[model samples]
Structure formats: structure tokens, C-alpha cells
Target: MEWGRCSEKELKDLEAIVGAENLSTGESALGLVSRDESYYTPKIPPQVVVMPASAEEISAILKIANPRRIPVTARGAGTSIEGNPVPLFGGIVVDMQRFDSIIEIRPEDFITVVEAGVGYKDLNKALGRHGLFFPPDPGAAATIGGMIGNNASGVRTIKYGATKDYVLRMTVVLANGKIMEIGSLATKSSSGYDLARLFVGSEGTLGIVTQATLRLAGIPAHHSAAVATFPTLQAAAQAVFDIMRWGFSPTALEVLTADLVQMLNRDRGLGLREEHTLFLEFQGASEIALEEELGAVQDLCQEAGALSFQPGLGIDERNKLWEARYETYESIKHTHPGADPFVADVAVPISRYPEILEYTAEIIRDHGVTGYPFGHAGDGNLHVVFMGDASDEEEWGRIVRANEAIVSRALELGGTCTGEHGVGIGKQPFMEREHGASLGLMREIKSLLDPQGILNPGKVFP
Candidate 1:
């Protein structure tokens, strides 16, 4: 649907609601707002951008836009790779950057209250003082609102869970300019509806999150990191399956391919083994207990054909050891300049993890595409990145085919097309396949919440 663009009068009214300096229609600002990290091409810049500092301001802006049937997309730092924040239809883009403020940090309650624009790094800094943290580390630049919107999670998810699990309550502005407060700070609730969860991963289509109350975890007293090398990806995946089934929980368990390791060493000068490696971390009651757990994991790895086990016990060592996993995307881009990169993640049952990896490897090999396969193995989620020259349209098609094959197989194995990253436009094809008839119910809910369909149009669905 073609959304109506904001006219001079509408833009002026938006400026009135959030000040002239807080609103922009400039080409440069629009250009920056038009694109995200997604592969979807030729940015569709918004007609205007409004930076609201509060939910009331957002409601005012929406009140103006809703009547005119203008598309309003909520965005934070625009770090979403799924094109979640990109304005596909030109209209008003709600920039939530000014809404950043740590409203409260209740150490005793193990909850934090922050505005939508609060970034993960800043939240972590505040939580550090209290020796607590929001465990779901989605990405470096993700905001709390963005994380909650996408229900983002990462390696830390092995033990804690996703952004959805930590989101206790949120202040949301519905599509029709009505504000609604959902959820409670209570440890558990038998309330009317778990409304907070409905919007957690809605990708901003349902509502604009203005504030969030997140559940935090205490910093482990004893922590250690390790990397166990294996001759093959199959063996590493096997070890991961065994470790998870053995009732041992890892703070983070990552699987990196040999090629990715080589690229990391060449680009970052981290001399990691150029073989499939299982990166593991332990956190527990005491140093002695942590060591014992590590030993048990070491035994499992050895049984699964681990080549060597290396430990990173100190602070610096632990950080550096995990750096290899963190530097993956940059390494891929650096090693092959001008290659268009497409990253996709899928999660499966722990038992099927190894077969899926092996099958994905075959698909990449058959297509002759440079694929980087890595991710949180403990959670049975894997991310594979395919890179090829931008000018090579045929290779792009090949990559798309690879994505289709992997996602389809993942579904067949009772897995999701996206493990952490929310479905923006890229994964829309598999939505029906994954959710089946439930897709209709989801659409109904979206319609009920956003009757005019003005909020974040052209997302989470075709």
C-alpha cells in the first residue's frame, strides 16, 4: 500500500509536537534513515523524521499521522540488519534517540527501567556498578527498545534467554495515538493477558515501545572461558549436543568454522586454530566448581574428538579469547572486499544441530559460495553468512537459493527461520511456512492494534 506523505502543514505540526530541531526532512538525514544493514537495496527514505523524547510526544505525533494514514516507523540506532527500522513507504519515521534515559535500576528487584533509546553498552555500564546485567546481548549497538522490538538475543542466551525473557514491562504507544501500559514488575503474574510478550518481537508493527523494564542477572562470582578445537564441524557440533544434553549449562557456547578462524587470524592477528572450534564459558558458585564443570566439558569434547582444549582464565585472556567470535563479520568483509554479504540465522533442536551444519556446508559447497558458519551452539542456533561480488547477480541468486534451502530444512527439522534477528522483509517468505495458520491470527492482532496499518508498514509480512 502506498502511504500518504506528510505535507508542509503535517511536517509543521510534527515540528510543533517535538520542536523544529528535533524533526528533520533534510536529504542527508533522510538518506541516513533510509538504509539499514539489510541487503534490500535502494533505500526508501522517510518523508520526515521526528525525534520524540517521551511517549506523550510520540502519541501526539501519531495522533497527527494516523488520521492521514501516514506510515510511522519507530527506529533507534538503525543497527538492525533485518531492515526492521527502514521506512519502506515514505512517511514519518519516529527516531527514538532522544528518549534515552535510565529511569530506574532496582538492584534488589533485579529490574531496570529505561527509555526506548537506551543502548546496550550504556545499560551494561550502569548495571556494572550494581554487579548485575541484562543477559541478552543482541549486538553491540542495539538499543533496549530495538532489542525488545526484535526480541534480540545472542551467545549469552545459552544460559539466560532472549530479550523477551528479560522484558518485564513496557510502556507502549498504540497505533491510534493511545498510550497503554502493559505488564508488571512482579516476579510472576496470572494476569488477564501476557500483553508485554505480544509486542516483544513484533518488529514495531504492533506498537512503538517508549520505555522498558528489563530483568537483570547477577554477575557470576566465578567465570572462565575456553576454546576446544575439533578436526571437523560435525565433531564440534556433536560435542555441543552432548554438553547441552549432559545437563551442563554454558554461559556462552559458540561454533566457528575453520575458514572463519583463518580469516580472523589474518585480519585481527589472533592466532586461533584454523579448525572448527567450540568456544565455551563457565560461570558458577566457586572457582573450584567452575573448574570441575570445565573438566567435565573437556571430557565430553575429548569424547567427541576434540583436538585440544585451551583456557582463558584471566580477565584479559577471557576477553581476548572471545574476541575471535566477536570479530567475525568484520573479518569476512575485510578478507573479501566488494563482496555482498547476506547473513541468516536458524535454530534447531540440539540433536539436529550437527546434521543441519553439515547440510548447510554441502549447500554452500554445491553453490561454490564463500560461506561463514558460526553461532551460539549451546542454544542450537547457527548463523551463516554468504558473500559474493555485488555485480554478480547470478551469485546473488545462488546465495538466495542457499538461504531458502537452509531455512526450509531448518523448518523441516522443527526449527525457526530466525533465531535472534527478527523477521524484517528478508524472512517474510518463510513466515507462513513456519507459522502456518497462526500467521492469520498474527495479522488479525496487528490489524486490531494498528487498524490504519500506519505503524511500520511493509514489515513482518509481505
Candidate 2:
């Protein structure tokens, strides 16, 4: 389907709805919203960038765009690495930054009402006051809306969950200027179709979320962190699988490769052992309970052939370690000055975690490319960042082939093309192979919700 262009009259209509100051067609403004943190580039630049402060304003803008068939791409903090928010068709890019507002925090109910543009760290800071937090740590300065768009989850997901688990309700603006609320404020519901969940990871192809009510988790009274080194990546992965299989509940379980550990040591002055390592964090209600659990974990790691197991890190040391872990992507990028990273995010069953890691290492070695493998190992998620020069088609081709091989292996192991990152341009090709016949139903749902297909035109579908 051909998308309508943003004409001068349509631009005037948008400015009238959002005011001239809230709208911009400037070169810098268009450039800013044209792409996200992904390696993909936009096919064309957006004609205008509009920052709407309310659902009503967004409704008005969508009203004008829907009839005209102008593509509307909703953007949050622009932190997604999958090109989830790129304005590929280039019509009106709706910037949601101005909608930042923490409306309400009901500590008793373990719920919080917030506007879509609020940052993840900002909300956590406020929630910390009440001994509660929204526990889908995506490790980026991402907006709540963007997190919901991708259904993001990080290391903590092994114990807590992803953004989709915490989202109770959302106020969304559908195509053609319809403002509707989805989901329930109650804890559980056997209600109709789960429209709230449908919109959570839709990547704004179905609707634009304006506000949300999220479920929160309480802060644990006691927490402990440890690092376990292994002789090989497979050994570390086996330990992770065994720990989870034996009913060990860790708050965060991350695995870093030897090369990645070396990079972290050089970049962050960590001075860590440059070997395959596992960073583990456990939280509980009492110190004694945590200590007991750590002791068991150490025994399990040793049984799995751990080279060394160091447990019981202090608060400051744990914080510094996590800070460096969160900066893994940046550290890799910094190490390779002018190279672009092609990240492959995949997940499989816990039993197959070790096999996938070994397969990934082999694929990287066979392709003759620099790859960093790491991720939330407890949940069987693996992220391999392949660094290369984008302009060098030959070298980048090898990286692409290696990524495809890894994803194919994950799918064969009963996994998914993307564990947390959404199906933006990067993983579109694997949608059919991953979903099979169900992909057609998804496209039908997309068409049903957006007949004109003006919302995030080139996304989700292949």
C-alpha cells in the first residue's frame, strides 16, 4: 500500500492542533527522529516532528493523518537498537518526550500510574521511596512507552519479568483519532481478548500508548552478589542451566565471554579475570536465607567445573560491577573505534542453553568475525554483538550470515528470533520461519486494527 505524503496543508493542520512551537520541519529535527540506535537507516526522512503533550493532541494529529494515509511513527527516548521507532515511511513522527508525568503512585496497591514518556530510571527513583520498583530493567535510559513497545526485559527478568508482565492498563490512541483505554486495574481478570497485551509489544503499529498503570515489585530486604569463573563458555552456561533447573532463584544471572571480560577490564578498570564468567545476584527477605542460597549456588558451580567461585560482594562492589555490566555494549563499541555492531538476540530452553552457546562460538569462529556473546543466562537468552564496518559489504555479509545461523539454531531449539528486542527491521526476515502459520493471523490483526496502515508503516511484518 502506498502511503500519503505530508503536504503543506497537512503540516498546517498538525501545527494548528499542537501549536507551531510543538511542531518542527527543521532539518535537525527531522534528522533526530529519522533513525534510532539501530544499524538500519530510514528509507526517507519524516516530513515533520510533532511533540504532543496529551492524548487529545495525539488524537487530533492522528485524525488528520489517518484519512490522508500519512504514516505515523510513535517515538519515545530513541534508545531501541532494533529500529523499533524509526520513521521508515516518513510522514509525521510523534515525539512523546513532552508527555512525561508521574500521575499517581499507590504503594498499597503496588501500582503506579504514569504518562508514557517517563524514563525508566526516573520512575525507579520515585518507586524506591516506597520500597517498590517496576522490575523490567532494559539497561538503557528508555522511556516507559518504548519499553512497552518492545516488551523489554533485562538480567532481572530471570526472577521478576518483562514490561508486559507489569503493564496493568494503558490509555491508547488508535488510528482515526479514537482514544480508548484497555486492560484492568484489578490484579487478575478473565476478561475478553487481552487487548492491553496486544498493544504492549505491537511496536506502535496498532496504536500509540499515552499513559499506563503498571504493577510494581517490592524491594528485597537482603541481597547478595557473586561472580563465578569457568574454564569455557559452555561450562558457565551449563552452570546457569543447572542452577535454574535445580530451583535456584537468582534476581539477576548474567554471563560474559572471555573477550567481553577483557574489554570490560580495559574500559572500566575492573581488573576482572579475563575468562568466561557468571555474575549472579540473589535477593531474599533475610541475610541467612541469602547466604544459604549462595552456598548452594557455589557448590553447584563447583560441580559444573567452575574454576573459581567468589561470593558475598558488598553493596558498593556489587553496584560498580553492575554499572560496568550495563555498559557492555558501549564498551564493545568503544573498543572498536569505527565499527558498527549487529546484535543477535535469541533465547531457548534452559536445557539447550549450553548447546546454543557452543554453537554460537563455533559460528563466530567459522565466519572469521569479532563477536561478543553474553546475556541473561538464567532465562536462556543470548546476545552476540558482531562488530564490523558497515560500508564493507563483504565483511558485513559474513556477520549477517553468522547472525542468521545463530537465530536459525535458536529457532530449531524451540526459541524465538528476539528475546526482548522487538521485530523491527533487523529480525523481520525470520518472522515467517519463527511464527509459521500464526504469522498470517498476526497480519490480519494488524490490518483489523489499522486498515489504512498509517501507524508505523514499515515494521513487524516482513
Candidate 3:
């Protein structure tokens, strides 16, 4: 859809609503919020940036922009790996950082009311005082609002579940500037329409979330971590299944290939084994029980033909070992500066996890494409970074083909096109292939909520 340009009258009116101090039409601000942390191309700058301080202001802005058919893409921290908050139509980018506030913490109720701009780290820091934590740490400085947008799940997702699971309520401003306070605090509600779930992963296409009430989990008293290296990637993936089937609930179960390990070692020189490894951690209240849990997981790793397994005896040691898992993305980029990184992620059934990884490896090897493979094996979410030759068109084509083949195979294995990263512009082509005719239903819902098609245009569907 061709979008209407922001006229002088419209810009002046927006400035009046948000005040001149909170809005900008400058090129620098437009470019900064143009794209997220993804390789999705052609950064389209918005006409204006609005920094609304409250939900009321957001409602008013939406009320004006929606009628004017101005695209308003809600942005939070700009940490998305999928161009989720990128403005595709060059409309208005609503900067949500000013709304940062941990409004209230109901410790006794195990729920916290926070503005959409509040960071998960700060919320957890405040919750730590009450011995509680917000689960679904997406391992980035992603705001609670963005996490809700993608329904983000991180390493701990093996145990804690995703963002949609923790969201109890939300104050969402629809496209027409109507504020709908959806969801309830009650643990179980057989109420009409689970509206909160609809918006949780809507990617701000349905409505703009201004505030959220998140469920909190208590901080476990005792926790232990272990790192084990396997001879092959399949062995590491299978170990996750074996450990899980043994009735063990590990907090985080990650799988990293030898290439990633080598990159991590060369970049950080931590002396880690350059082999396919599984970074596993267990959490509980009892120190002895946690130790036993780690030992049990280690035993399973040994049974899965692990070369060596090391269970950290202290917290610092465990964290140091686990650091390898977090640094793989940066390590790949730093190690291969000229290679354009294409980090594609997909999730399949647990039993099919190893099958897909092996399949992906075969495709990569056949195409002669270099990439780093890693994932949260505990939940069958595999993330691979294809470092395509930056200036080589032929090699870039191979990388693109490999990505397509990988997503296709994941869908064939009863998985999704995206495991955590939402269907931003990069993943649009695969929506119809993944969702089939249901893609029409999604469009219908999009049209119903945003009849003018102004909210996050040219996303989720082709």
C-alpha cells in the first residue's frame, strides 16, 4: 500500500500534541530508529519521531495519526533481530523510552505493574529486593514492551516459558485511539476473549501497548551450572533430550557447535574445548539437591558420549563458563568483519531437533557456506549465523538458499519459521509458506483492528 506523506499541517499538529520538545523530524533521529539490529535492508526513515510521556498522550497521538493514515511503529530499546520495530512506510516512530517507570510492585500478589518502556533488568533488580524475578529473559536490553511484542523466550525458556505466559494484563491503545485495558490478574479466568494473548505477540500491529502487569517468579535459593563437550553436534542435541527424559528440569540447556566454540576461544581465549558443547544449568532451593541435579545431568552427558563434562563448584565459575554462550553472536561478527551475518533461528520438535541440525549442516556443507550454529536445545530452538562473503553476490545467494532450505525443513518437521524472532520484514516471504491459508485470517484480523492498515504496515505477511 502506498502511504500518504506527512503534510506540514499534520507535522505541526503532532508537534502541538507532543510539544516541540518531544517530537523530531530531523534526519539523524529518523535514521537512528530506521532499522533494528537485523540485516533487513533499506532503512526507511520516519517523517517524525514522537516521544509520548504517558498512555493518554499515546492515545491522543494514535487518535490523530490513525485517522490521518500515518504509520506509527512503536519502538522499544531497538534490540530486535527481525526489524520488528522498523518503520517500513516512513510514517511516525513512537519512541517509548520516556515511558520507563516501574509503576507498582505487588509482592504479595506476585505481580508487578510497569510501563511498556521499563527494561527487564531494572524490573528484575527491583523485584530482587522482594526475592522475585520476571521470567523470560531475552538476553538483550529488550524492554518489557518489545518482549511482549515478540512473545520473546530466552535460554531459561526451557524452564520458565515465554513472555506471553507471564503477562496478566495490559493497557493497550488501539489504532483508533481507544484504550482497552485487557486481561486480568486472576490466575484462571474463563472470561470472554483472551484479548491479552492476542496483543502479547501482535508485534504492535494490533494495538500499541503502553503499560503491562507482569507475573513474577521467586528467585531460586540454589543454582548450579555445568558445561559438557560432545564429539558431534547431534550428540550435544541428543544429550538435551536424554537429560530431559530422565525427569530433570534444567533452567537452561544450550548447544553450541565447534565453529562457535573456536570463534569464542579465539576471540576471548577462555581455553574452552573447540568441540560441540552443551551449556547446562539447574536451579532449585536446596544446595545439595542442585548439586545432585547437576551430577545427574552430567551423567546423562557422559552417557551421550560427551568428551568431558565440568560442573562448576561456584557461582562465579559457572557464570564464567556460561559467558561463552552469550558471546557467540558478537564473536562471529568480530572474527569475520567482511562477512554479512545472517542469523536465522527456527524450532522443531525435540526428537526432530538433531535431525534438523544435521540436515542444516549437510546443506551448509554442500553449498560451502560458513556459519556458526547454536541453540536452546532444551526447547529445540536452533539459531544459526550464516557469515556470507560480504562482497560476493554468488556466495550471498548460497547463504539465502541455505536459509530458505533450513526454514522449509523446520516447517516440514512441524516447527515454525521463527522460534523467538517475530515475522518482521526479513521473514515475511515465509509467512504464507509457514502459515498457509491462515495468513488470510491474520490479514483479516489486521484489517479489523487497523482498518486503515496504518499500524506497522508491510509486516507479518507479504
Which has the better lDDT: candidate 2, or candidate 3? 2
Q: Write the per-residue lDDT of candidate 2 for residues 163-212, one digit (tens) a residue.
A: 99999999999998899999999979989999899998999999999999
lDDT of 2 at 126: 99
Off by over 4 Å in 3: 42-44, 389-391
Q: Which candidate is the best by TM-score?
A: 2
After best superposition, candidate 3 residue 409: deviation in angstroms?
0.5
Worst 10 residues of 2 by lDDT: 35-44
| Alpha-carbon TM-score of each model against the true structure | 0.98, 0.99, 0.97
In order, what is each prediction's RMSD in angstroms? 1.2, 0.8, 1.4
All candidates in order of TM-score, best leading: 2, 1, 3
TM-score of 2: 0.99
The CA lDDT at 160 in model 3 is: 95
Cα lDDT, all candidates:
0.88, 0.93, 0.87
Error of 3 at 337 (Å): 2.1
Per-residue alpha-carbon lDDT of candidate 3 for residues 1-462, written as tens digits (9 for 90 to 100): 567667898888888888999999888888888878876543455889999888788888887787778888999998888788889888898999997999999999999999999999999999999999999978878999999999999899999999999999999999999988999998679899898998988888999999999999999998888889999878888898898888899999998888788888889876888898888888899989988888778888998999999886488777766765676787788888877788888999899998988998898898799877789899999888998775688988899889889999999999998999898887887888888888899899899999998888877878
Write the number of the candidate with greater TM-score, choosing between 1 and 2: 2
Which portions of model 2 miss their true places by more than 4 Å?
A: none
